[model samples]
Target chain A: MDILDLAFMQRALLAALLVGVTAPAIGTYLVQRRQALMGDGLGHVALTGVGLGFLLNESPVWMATAVCIAGAVVMELIRWYGRTRGDIALAMLFYGGMAGGVMLMNLSDSGSSANLSSYLFGSIATVSEEDLVAICILAAFVILTTVGLRRQLFAICQDEEFARVTGLPVRMLNLLVAVTAAVTVTVAMRVVGLLLVSALMVIPVAASQQIARSFKATFALAVGIGVTVTVSGTATSYYADVPSGATIVLFAIGLFVVLTALATPLAKRRAGRTAAAEECTLEAPGERTAADDVRV
Target chain B: MEQPVIALRGGVASLGGRPVLRGVDLAVRPGEVVALLGANGSGKSTAVRSIVGQVPLTGGELELFGTPQRRFRDWARVGYVPQRTTAAGGVPATVREVVSSGRLARTRFGMMRRADKEAVIRALELVGMADRLGDPVDALSGGQHQRVLIARALAGEPELLIMDEPMAGVDLASQEVLAEALRAQVARGATVLLVLHELGPLEPLIDRAVVLRDGCVVHDGPPPEAVGQHALPGHDHVHPHAGPAAEPIRTGLLT
Candidate 1:
C-alpha cells in the first residue's frame, strides 16, 4: 500500500510527523541533562494512566493524559521522600502505579475493552481521527513550551545548582521538565506504545549526538531521525506484516549504528584538522583574537 | 563603619531536626573579602547560603542591603557562586548565555530583556571570557568554567558576592585567576564571602575571616590573624552550605 493511501494511514502519518518533531526536541535536553531514563520511567507510569482512563468510562486518551500528568507530579514529590536514591523512588512509583493500574483494569472488567494490546504495543493501522487531533494539539503545546523556554531549559539541564546560584529558579524549571516529559509521553503513546515511547524519544537524539558538531546541530539531527524512524516504521509495518512498535525501535537502533559508524571517521578527521588549526592559532593568539571571540 | 550589605541576626538553620547554624550573627560590608573558615561541618557554607536565600533559616532574621527581609526573594541584591562548576558547566550553552543567567533575579519573571543581555556581556567581559563568548561552557577547562560561573554570579551586579569553596579542586592557575577576579570584585565595592577549610592559600585574598565550628561562629576576625589556625583536622570543609555540618563535633563551645 502507498504510505498515505488509507485514511487511517494518512492520520497515522500526521500523528507520527507531529510526535516525531516534538518528542526528540524535548528529548534532546533530557539526553543532555543525563535524565534520559526519565522518559522511559514516565512512559511506564503512563500505563496506569491508561488503566485509570479505562476505569472511568472517560475517553481513555484524556484519562490517560491526566493520569500521566498526575504521575509526573508524583515523581516530583518523590524528591522530598529521599535524596541520592531517585532511582529507588522511581522504582517504588513505577511498581505502585502499575499495580494500581492492574487493580483498576481488573475492577472495570476492561481487560480487553480498550484494545489494551494496541495501547501497550501500538498499531498504526488503528489510528482514529480523534487520536490524530489529540496528537496535533498536544504536539503544538510541547513545541511552543520547548522553544519559548529553550535557553533556560538548556541552562538548567546542563547545571541546575549553578543555574540556581545564578537565580534561575532551578526547582521550578525542573518541575517544568518533568511535566513536559509527562506530556510528551502522553502524546507519543499514540504512535509508539507507552512502553516504547521513550525509545523513540531517546534513540534518535542519542544517535544524533554521536555525529553532530554542536548541541543545536544534534537537536536538528535528532528531529530528522525521529521523523525518519516514524515514517519508515509505519510504512514497513503496513507492508511487511511486522509489529509496528518493534519495527520503529529496530529502525531507530539501525540508524543509531549507521550514524555512529559514519560519525567516527568524520569526527577523527575533524579532530585532526582542528588540532592542527588550534596549534597554529594559539601560536599567534594575539593575531586571531578577532575571530576566536565568536568562534563556536 | 559601614553597615553590612548582608546581615544575619540570631539566625538558626537545621537539617533533619539538628541545628547547623545556631544563633549565628554575622555582617559583611562592601569592599570586604570575608573568608568563612570552618572544619568539615562548621556551617560556613550554610551561613553564606542563608545570606543569599538558598537555605531557609529555621529561626532569626536575614536582612539584605540593610532592609529587614525574611526571604531569598528580598536578597536578590546578593549574588551567589557555589563550589561546583561542573553542575552548571555541563549545559551546551555558550559562556555568554551562562553569564546572562545572572540577571534572572532582576528580570521580570526571569525574562531577559535588552539591558539584561548587555549586562550579561559585560559580566563575561569582567571575568575575561568575553573573548570566548560563543564557546560551549563544557568545552572550557575547569578554571574557565569556574570563571564563567563567577561571571554568571556577577551578572546581577550584586553588592554582595557569596561563594562556597570557589577554589576547591581548582588548579593553581585557576586558583590564581579566580583569586584575582575575586579581589577585583571586592575592589569594585562588592562584599565577598567565601567558605574555605584552610586560610593558607587564600590568606592574602581575604580581608576578614569568619570561622564556624559545630554550627556556630567560633572565630570572626581578619584572615591575617586567623591564618595560622585550622578549625579542625580531617574535615573536608567542602560540604553543602545550607545543611547542618556533616561532622560530629564538640557542640557546646559556641553555645
Candidate 2:
C-alpha cells in the first residue's frame, strides 16, 4: 500500500492540513500586532501542562489546552496592568514555563519522558484517532471566534487607544485575541510540537506581509503559504526520515528568506512608479523637477 | 439655555498614581470651535481623553450631548483624532479600509452598507486623500498620515469632532489643507474641540480658547494675543502685568 493509504500517515496529514490553515489564520493578527512571540510563550506553558498530565497519568493534550488558556488570560492581565514594562512580565512567563515543564517531567516516570520527547519534536506516526478529533473540534472553535471578531480585533491591533475612544470594547477584544492565540498554539502543538509551534503561527504570516498590500490579502496569502509548507514538509519528513516539526519550521523559514529577498526590489520599483505618477498629476508641467522621480 | 455639546465639570483624573487634571472645568457649546491650549504635561490631552471615556476620572463629572458619560451609548455621534505618532503598528491597512473602520459604531454586525462606503469616500475627498484610497497607510508621509486619520474621523459623520494635536508634526502645506477642512466642518455646524500648542492656521477658526497650566484652567476666553506675536523674541516673558493669580496665564504663554 502507498504511504497515503496507511492509516497513521493519513491521520498525520489531516492534522497537518488543519493546523496549517488555523495557525497562520490566527497568526496573521499576532504578527500584525507585533506579538509574534505570544504563540511561543503559550506553547511553553502548554508543555508545562503536558508535564503535569504525565505526573497525574492523564491525557496530556487536554491538560495542555486548559493550562494554555489559563496562561493566556494571565498574560493578558499582565500586559494590561504592567503597562510599558509588559514585555518583562512576558519574558518571565516564557522562562518560568520552560523551567517548570522540565522539572515536572523529571518528577514523572522515565517511560513518560520518552512520550514528552515526542511532544517536544513531534512524532507524526503517534497521532491517535482521539487526538485528531480533539484538534478538529478546537480548530473549528478558533476559526469561528476569529471570523466573528475580525473587524474589532483589527481595530484594536491598529490602535488600542483609538479603538477605545470609538467604544469598541478594546479590553474585551484584546482578551479575545489572547484566548484565540492560546487555542491556536495548543492545537498546533500536535503537528509542530510545543517548542516549534510558534514557527507555524508566525513564519508564513511574516512571509505574506512582505508581498501582500492589504490586511485581508496578507491574511489570505499567509494561510496559503502555511498550508503549502505544512503539507510538503510532512511529506518530505516521511520520505527522508527526519523530525517532522523541525522539518516544517525549517521549510517555512526558507520560504520567508526567499520572499524577503524578492520583495525589496519589487516594492522599491512600485514606489518609484507611484511617485512619478503623483508628481506628474500634482505639479505644473513646466515646474516638474527631476528630483521628484527619485524614490525616498 | 442650550446645553454644551461637551461638559467636563470639576474633572479630576490621575494616571499611574500621578494627578494630571485637578478640578478642571470645560464646556463647549454646540457649533463652537474650542481650542484646548497648554504645554506638554499640562493635562490637555488627559482632559479630552476623559471626555471620550478613555481616561477614568478619579473624581468628576463628564457629560456628552446632555447625556452622562457613563450612560452615553451614542458613539457614532462623536469623532476623535488622537495625537499623531509613528503610524507603524499592527496590520498594514489600506487608506480605504482605515477610513471605513471609522463607521463601525454605526454599522450592524461590522458590515458596511453602501452608504457607509460613500461616507468613507467623501471623507477621503475632504482630506484630499481620495486618490490614494488603495495605498497602504505606512507608505504615506507624516502629514499625509495625519490627513488619513482625520478622514477616518470624518467618515463617521460625527456631530462633535475632538482632535488632539492634529497639526503637531504636520507640514505647513498639510496644515493649510487641514485648516480648510476644519473650516468646512465648522461651516457645516460641527462642534469641534482641538488641543493645540499655538493654534497656528487654526487660530482664525477658534472661537474660544481654554488654556491649562499644571492641570488648572488659567485662561478661558479669546485666543491669547501673545500667541500671534510668537515671532517676537521673549514673547512668552512679556506677560500682562498682573497679580499672583495671573501667574498661571503667564506660564501658559510659555507653551
| TM of chain B, each | 0.78, 0.88
TM-score of each: 0.83, 0.89
Estimate, for each residue in A179-268, the C-alpha lDDT of model 2 and write its tens digit: 888888778887889888888888999899889878888888888999998888888888998988999999999999999999999999
Model 2, span B1-255: residue lDDT tens: 789999889999998899999999999999999999987899999998889888899897889999999999888899998874323355567888777878787788788889999999999999899999998887787778888889989988889999988886566677888999899999999999999877777989999999999999999999987645566764443323223522322101011
* TM-score on B-chain, cand. 1: 0.78
> Which window of 10 residues has the lowest lDDT sum in candidate 1 chain B?
B246-255
Q: Which window of ten consecutive residues has the lowest lDDT sum in model 1 chain A?
A: A287-296
Candidate 1 wrong stretches, greater than 4 Å: A84-89, A106-114, A213-215, A277-296, B1-3, B15-18, B67-69, B74-76, B85-93, B108-115, B197-205, B226-255
lDDT of 1 by residue, A72-164 (tens): 887877764666797788898887776776667777766673567678778767877877777778788889877778767866776565566
At residue B4, candidate 1 shows an lDDT of 74
lDDT of each: 0.74, 0.83
lDDT of 1 at A189: 83
